[model samples]
Target: MEGKNSQLQQRKDDALPRGTGNLCQWYVDQAENATLRDVEGNSWIDFAGGIAVLNTGHRHPRIVQAITDQLAKFTHTAFQVTPYESYVALAERINKRVPIAGKAKTAFFTTGAEAVENAVKVARAATRRHGIITFGNAFHGRTFMTMAMTGKVAPYKRDFGPMPASVFHARYPNGVTGISTDDALASLHDIFTQDIAPQDVAAIVLEPVQGEGGFHIAPPDFLQRLRALADQHGILLIADEVQSGFARTGKLFAMEHFAVKPDLITMAKSLAGGMPLSAVSGRAEIMDAPGPGGLGGTYAGNPLSIAAAHAVLDVIDEEQLCERALQLGAQLTELLHSARTTYAAITDVRALGSMVAVEFADAQTATQLQQQAMQRGLLLLTCGPQGNVIRFLYPLTIPDAQFRQALDILGSLLNQPRS
Candidate 1:
């Protein structure tokens, strides 16, 4: 009686956990650079980019070829056992590319969350301290430790209590939310004063651009100040570039925009062109703090994913995706501002390269806008504590004509009043 997707949705509701949030009702049968098609042959412009995980687009030819070649060679030997060259090569490439200073080293992992957890392990081992300081509104990961590090509670941290201890949270500086750099610094100072002393802290972790925290861009000075603080107290600084890496923010890494460099950088999301791979690149000696057999996973740096990552790197450079991100960012920002003239409820439009988000006056309007867009074959995603922000994560490889079409749909939606 109904469409295939509608039937599947019913099954999904019956089988899948309620905890698993499904933003799109239709199940995607296929995806291209910046669009998705359902099993029923309905097409939708993909603005979510698989939750900022497809900057290189869905199955780039280069990535596909790389994976194919690797598949012919061998699938898994486990890096710790019969190690492969591709894994080593990928690590070398990441070490060179990341913004860490002085003989950086890299270790691979299977997911962004693993990279983060390992980064903390390396920090704690290097500093010989167990205390970690994160920020409010930050979304590090979903694991027990990361859940503790994460600031939001409702969806991610709800009923997942008894999180790891000694993980403190300070404020993440967001100009849109009125949390100034000074205010954030004050919060950090308070953490040092009230919770854990600076000397006992292992690392201060933060996102270059808060991805799920409403796409808030951290102030330039805020990171620089954290660098200084870390140095003063002998604490490592870790930039969680999981969502903002691989040219998502114009630079190869978002930290490059800042004057200072973090001690370690965690990269995932678009690292392997849709393949599952993540890495932690950092100072050599610090990275070496973990003893033999101290870190690693069987699936970490699978040859296929490593090969795909190499291809993703090549695609970014050759395709000039960094520059493309900048160009797309300009267009998106301009469109949002223009729409703001018509819809004052569109309070803010934040952009850092192609990573853009439009914040509405309230959560209801934002959710309604996302539904409105989806009904017109444009997929959208909302984030923020109150769910009042719609983040744009279209692929950098999106065709120009398609990009404009998605923009037009958004512009039209902005003109409509909340009924």
Candidate 2:
């Protein structure tokens, strides 16, 4: 008598570890553009965007065709074993596009964590230092080194044995949370004075726009200060654009918004339009510090992923998704700000382009809104260290009519009395 979704849920619960959490109970039967259909025929407007991995939307035709073309030719040859033109070509394209100064070099990987880890490797190789400094509420990755670099502890680090050493945390500026730019910088200096000396630190990695910690846009002045500090200390500045890249932030890269540039940048989500591909681009000299074979994987630049990445770049340019991101984000931000008047539970609404989020007065309120929106056939995701911020990661390619419908559902939910 169980429905297909219920049956699948039961099977999943039995087969998978609880650590691999599921936000929706229903199983997806199909997905396209900005909508997902469950096995029961219910369609949900997707706002999670597969956690910012679908800036170009699900199963985009161009990306699909590119993947199909590669599938017909080859899947994997291990770039390190047998070099491929697509991998080199993709790196060249990225090298030209990255915001780093002086010729940049890019290397591909399989995931955000891999890109981040390799960035650190390159930084250490170049600077001859082993220490890494990240910030509070930063979610770099689930790997041991990244886990240590990550600032939050509850779920990401919980039950995971001791993290690799030489990683420290500093405060990230949050005006809403009362941590200012000065305070964040002070925390960094405290780490230098109290924990690791500046000369010993290889890199200071941070998200230009913190994703899971809540969509807090790093203030421009703060970034400038960090650049100055990094320069003064001979430490590399790494912008983890894993969640903020690929036109999601009204620009191809969030670093484009600031005048200061990073020595290296880590990217993954939305890089290959849902294909598992990550990359780190940085100054050529720093990237080359790692000897050959020191920075590649068996599946680093799978031909299929490379093909998809090419198509993704093409689609972003052809569709003007960067400009579209700005337009859509502006509309959503205006809506949330307008809703603030009626919803007392809405404490803050913030955004950097379409990477938007709304913080409620309490975690319960945020979760309630997410549940209510899901019930209305709209998928939403909640984040923040306290679980009080609901982030919107809707694809930039979402049709206007569908997007407007999702907004209406959210408006109605917000206008209602808090339960």
Reference-based lDDT, residue 295, model 2: 93
Candidates in order, TM-scores: namely 0.98, 0.99
- For residues 200-276, write the lDDT of model 2, one tens digit per residue: 99999999999999999999999999999999989999999999999999999999999999999999989999999
Residue 71 lDDT in model 1? 97
Off by over 4 Å in 2: 417-419
* Clash totals in order: 0, 0
lDDT of 2 at 183: 99
Per the 3 Å backbone cut-off, how many clashing residue pairs does candidate 1 have? 0
Highest TM-score scorer: 2
- Find the 10 residues in a row with the least total lDDT in model 2: 410-419
lDDT per residue as tens, model 1, 1-419 = 89898999999999989888688888889887887999999999988888999998997889999999999999998899999888888888888888988999999999998999999999999999999999988999998988888889978888875889999999988777688999999999999999998889999999989988989998888888888988999999999999999999999999999889999999998999888999999999999999998989999988889999999999999999999999999999999988887797888899999989999889999988899899998989899988999999999999999999999999898876543
